[model samples]
Target: MTEAAFIDIDWAGRPVRIEYQWIARDRAAAPLIVFLHEGLGSVAMWKDFPQRLCIATGCRGLVYSRPGYGRSTPRAAEEAWGLDFMHRQAQEVLPALLEALGIDATRDKPWLLGHSDGASIALLYAASYPQRIAGAIVLAPHILVEDLSVSSIEKVRAAYLETDLRQRLARHHDDPDSAFWGWNDIWLKPAFRHWSIEAEISAIRCPLLAVQGLDDEYGTLAQIHGIARRAAQTELFELADCGHSPHRDQPERLITAITAFIQQQPHGDKP
Candidate 1:
């Protein structure tokens, strides 16, 4: 396997340069898999999971940061994210990234494998552009904000400020606070209480897989269950002794489920 290039590509009407780690299996005909990271996630944070999955599935892969993570540009200090921050990611940033890389959403729909907030963004993207996505693997996605979420975020704030969480996060980000607070602030805001996307779940026509951890502290099982309720074809998986980050905590199980889902999904034009 050749090393993935840590290159740059413009996005979102800005000089947004992202790390495009890619590998082409067969230039003529291999499906693409785009990995969307969590809110505080970055290209480096994904470690080698993307590479492993790409190898396991025999597919080409692209994994990059969303503006304010990894080798991408940092978020502006004064730039407070709106309630529609996640929506902006789905509707704007993602498409731009794909276009910059010459990946046609219309002709060659890519499989989206997103984690946490990234998972929610994938859901939003799939629902809004039903015809542009092949299928999605959403892990620990939030359909609606819950009190447990707020509480867990608050705990994260404390951990970042008082413990080794900052040091740990430093390894993956140029500016850890930029990634941490940007996600934590918006999620913990009082005005963000009404943030919900359950209404859009019904609009997602793609085959879906939603996974959650039984010991997830940020949300209840309702997150995945709600998605299943909306999409009848959706399958759910719950891993015990796992927390919020399933990809990190339970990588083997996560990869197994995703690989199986992709293999079983009938490949054809998007619905």
Candidate 2:
């Protein structure tokens, strides 16, 4: 079973509400696995994937919506996100959320599972707080801006304007425009083309699993390959038929890989 809850925290000098859910709460001593959603994803958008993963691994799971998505606080329409938006989330928002929830990573040492933009944020967080994370499993993470990413985002922009993208996204986000533009505009920015975290990832010391689809339109294998080059401990998985979102495209395979990876870790034993 999953329990949904909210925490009020301060971000950028304003009170923001974060919606989060806990899966497998009965497993108090089990390792914690935090799920970071995609750019346009929310807690509700993840559906039952997090819960299913936690149940399979005998671990506790935490899934949450970022400040500007899902049922959480929406971004101001006029406010523009900077090139370092993902960096800010990893360095500032994540730490605050953990503290507010009384989760001491130094003591518990949670593992992170992030997809798409969330995966990039996970990489940044792991790099910044190397000792706090047990390990990280990132799916379709972007280490640097690629032409493919920008081009795909451009297509999404067109869809949002000419298609039903906004309407479909509204089913998941409280303010679909806030969620869509915040991610789209930042990625499409001219300055953002230079955004890269390859150097910083070298600081990570924990085990890492970087998975990407062979057919991912937003990024190429270079994303995970780059992580392996900088972080020697990284393991890469390239799924042939999968796309950007592996959980949705290849859920069973992803679960199997994740379970085996977690069990192989030094702290793998189930509590």
lDDT of 2 by residue, 33-151 (tens): 99999999999999989988987888999999998999899999998999889999999899889999999999989999999999999999999998899999999999999999999
lDDT of 1 by residue, 133-162 (tens): 988999889899999989988988999989
Best-fitting candidate, measured by TM-score? 2
Residue pairs that clash (backbone atoms under 3 angstroms), model 1: none
Instruction: Give residue 267's error in model 2 in angstroms.
Output: 2.1
Q: Each model's TM-score? A: 0.93, 0.98
- lDDT (0-100) at residue 164 of candidate 2? 92
Which candidate wins on lDDT?
A: 2
lDDT agreement of model 1 with the native = 0.84
* Model 2 residue pairs with clashes: none
Which regions of candidate 2 deviate over 4 angstroms? none
